[model samples]
Target: MTTNQRRAARFNKAFGNRLAGPLLSRMPGFGAVLHKGRRSGRVYRTPVKIFRTAGGFTMSLPYGPKSDWVRNVQAAGGCQLVSLGRRFDLVEPRVYHDREQRVIPRPLRPLLARFKAFDFIELRLAPAGAGRAER
Candidate 1:
């Protein structure tokens, strides 16, 4: 990440996120990624723009695929997604770069592209009674 990017990330971590997380977590087309720290074993919830795909969901890695939360999800092999105010367990995370940005809805493609976001992660919904639980 460049200096500006790193500073922006730090700013979000320290301030912006605290204000946006609660609202974003409940909004349609937006969600929260609930992942655990790979080493610290601490839990985190990050606001994200998520889109549904057949049998799964896709999230753009604007922070880049190497972001701590993304790494945590990959290392753990799964994570929980809070979408539309409901919690869903997800597994089989697949992170890859796609300039076509095909899995997500078309309208969002341009927006992500503008951010230079070509990397994304897709995860299948955990089977009912396998891991998913909603409230």
Candidate 2:
């Protein structure tokens, strides 16, 4: 992360996200990941571009793998996702860096590339009725 990129990121987090989060949460191919902070335990809902795959879902790490939301999800080993008015339990977070962005859908690759989102996170859906009896 260069100095300028860091500054821009901070600016986006402070202002841009406030406006974007709500819109993204409701958009197609986008979703909100709900996870708890590792240290603070406070929950966070982060907007992300998520695509369903054969096994699970893949998300473009636009802010990179070190983003707070990513770290929290990784630490917790799972997170809940809400998209298109549906809910999902995602587990086994795997962050990978790929220049080709092969895991991303064809039409959306260009947009993610423009954002320098080379890193991606993949998660598999929890088995059906898994832990249903727990709660």
Candidate 3:
């Protein structure tokens, strides 16, 4: 990580959780990615900037790919997305940089583009008939 990214991560860890996390996690068009710690086995809920796609949801990784939640999700191979008052069992995790920003909303694209936040974490919902649990 660059110096700026390291600093930003520190700031997010110190303030984002206490300030923005609770509010963002519950709002529409935004949700929490639920993943478990690889070693500790502790559950973590991370607030993310979410965009709906044809198949599932795409989220911006403001803290970049090195974020703990990202690693946890990748390690577990899936995670739960709590959004729209529903809990979805998301599978087939994919992380990449969408430089064209095609999946991002038009209004937010410019702002996100400023931060060069092209790294994304994508999760597709499990098939409808597959049993899943609620929040």
lDDT of 2 at 125: 87
Q: For residues 19-128, what per-residue lDDT tens digits would candidate 2 score against the true structure?
A: 78778877898988889999999987778888889878899887789888889999999898888777788899999999999988788789878878899999998887
Name the lDDT of candidate 1: 0.87
Which ranking of candidates, highest TM-score first? 1, 3, 2
Residue 73 lDDT (model 2) = 92
Candidates 1 and 3 compared: the better one by lDDT is 1
* Residue runs of model 1 more than 4 Å from their true location after superposition: none
Q: Candidate 3, after superposition: displacement of residue 87 in Å? A: 1.2
Model 3 segments more than 4 A misplaced: 133-135
Give the Cα lDDT of each candidate.
0.87, 0.83, 0.84
TM-score, one value per model? 0.92, 0.87, 0.89
| Candidate with more favorable, higher TM-score: 1 or 2 | 1
RMSD of 3: 1.8
User: Candidate 3, residues 39-109: lDDT per residue as tens digits?
Assistant: 99999888888888877788998778889889999999889888767788888889998888888878888
